[model samples]
Target: MARNIVISGASSGLGRALAIEFAGPGATLGLLGRNSERLDETAARAREKGAVVRSAAVDVRDRDAMRSFLLDFDAAAPIDCIIASAGVTMVTPVPGEVEDLTRAEELFDVNLNGAMNTIAPIAPLMRRRRAGQIVLFGSLAAFAPPPDSPSYAASKAALVAFALATRALYRADGVSVSVVCPGFVDTPMAGSYSSWKPLMMSPEDAARRIRRGLDRRKAIIAFPLPLYLAARCQQWLPDSLRTAAMLRFRAVQRLPVR
Candidate 1:
């Protein structure tokens, strides 16, 4: 039997690169994505590297589907890790300056709720076995909402508490919950929206760092030193001041959908 790993959002970008990074003759991969063609492409790449890859075009929001899939995937082979990489930006018909609640919900469903959906299903099994890893995708935006991406900021912000919570709760079960907060990566998802992305690395580079973090069982993995520092600083800033600054910053963008 080979070491098994499951990844969501494996159709493109970081997910695709991650599949490549973990590819090997002794590894088996279970990929989840909405696009069959793109998912097939990723599977092919992983297979070329000698990995046994299988994929399903399933929406993460479908709770029952997720649960069933996780159960079956784990049963087929002992799953060593699960990575929840599927997420969408704030595309609720709103762009910059303005902010709204509808956009917030849609993006939240895919980012935060989707994250929970991904981690929860396989948790029981991992707990019973007393060993496994869960990787949650967060963002540099989690620290500060950056006016323009309000809902997007809100969406990412929801994932911050996961690292500490998971570490404290799952330790007894020997299940490690890790969060990956990358500064910015050059991906189709990132390119779809316009923004000043700093210290952006290629998906390949991001995947490599993620792999290292998972191997070491790090509780939280953040990228590109500078962005990490800025995030920390925001955490220490005054709420009132941060709010004011955000308002001023928000003024520059058009407005997000409501």
Candidate 2:
């Protein structure tokens, strides 16, 4: 039997890639995104691949709406895997400039609280059944604070801890939780970065790796082995050396116009 999957942020980027990667006969997909046009496009593409797709233009930050969408989808087709991939990124300010407070708040709201809204409600249902997987999309940025985007780093860092704790809490209950900390994946989201992104992998490739990791039930799946190793080693560097190395990591884009 094909697995039933739910993915937040399915309008584009890694979320859309994963939707395509998981699409096939017998597979049922529930996708939630903030853009109706793009969400519909994604649904059409997945349907082409023979997957039964249900999509909604819904914001992950809207707790009630998200809860309703997730619960309703679960009732229709019990979700085997629920991936929290909806997120927004803020670029770092140029020299002598302060980070935008509003952008920072929005960052936390979407990347952190929004993720919680997307996955938390579904967790208890999965726990009760003792069957299901919850996957949180983290980032390589979580390993070390980048000089460019403090809030972005903080948000992902929180998820790293949360994902691990959640995994430990539900492991014995047959509910598997995994955190995927991908390196620079070539997606619209990563395009927001103006600095050099080393060891970037295509969304398609990254999705394959994540799916493989999930299949094996790995608790944490961080990828592009070389970059993952570097992120792990970065924290061990001397303060001065790390600061100098991280100088190249600044974000150059301004806040998106409303």
Candidate 3:
């Protein structure tokens, strides 16, 4: 197990569950999230499990702040694992309606650039030590881009590719990189979607699987065998057929009230 770990998006959903799952005696956790109160809650839970926890209410999209937070945490204790799990999702509001470009841009900023910010700062440090693990959170949508959430799917697909390339590049340095492509998870984010969610998993179960995958240094940790297979299969279908099939499951994402 990684003794010193850093996780972004640690306030809620799979990220929060992962933090709790990894917490225990001899572990040190550095957590980051946008919500201060919720981040504190996560830290408290980790502390209860006997892990030393440090938390920050910082947005992953701010590169400078993320770099500072990651570097400071690493300086205090050499980080063994870094999980870039911060992301957001949006969809076309209705059939034939294009998504707002501003919203799409914001989604990309969070899902893709934010992940880059979270990983870039500490990558070299880990390489110098010749030890570290990096995990990027992707989604099943990467395999089969959903019609309703084009930007969301594209962002995740880009992450999957980035993870693959980075994994290869860092392998020689003893730094391991893994990407997680999960199906629907019963998170508040997922709750916004009203479409049928096949094989939806609880955050705890998802976290356990992710932890196990990281322990083994697996390159890609996709879950729910059925959904994974189905997504992969969609890639081989004709473009029109694929799009039509995806339309059947189209869902509108309800933005949370501020």
Evaluate residue 74 in candidate 3 and report its C-alpha lDDT on the 0 to 100 scale: 94
**Candidate 3 lDDT, tens digit per residue, 132-181?**
99999999999977778888999999999999999999999999999999
Off by over 4 Å in 1: 91-98, 238-258
Which model is ahead, 1 or 3, in terms of lDDT? 3
Better of 2 and 3 by lDDT: 3
Q: Which candidate is the best by TM-score?
A: 3
TM-score, model 2 to reference: 0.96
lDDT of 1 by residue, 128-208 (tens): 999899888888877766766767777676676876688789999998888888987998877665556768899999999
Mind giving the per-residue lDDT tens digits that candidate 2 earns over 1-258? 228999999999899999999999999999999889998998999999999999998888899999999899999998889999999887756555656898889889999999999888889999999999999988888996677778888999999899999999999899999999998888777776577788888999999999999999998799988888888898899988888878877667743622
Ordering by TM-score: 3, 2, 1
Candidate 1: C-alpha lDDT: 0.81
Poorest 10 consecutive residues by lDDT, candidate 2: 249-258
Candidate with top lDDT is 3
lDDT of each: 0.81, 0.88, 0.92
Error of 2 at 235 (Å): 0.6
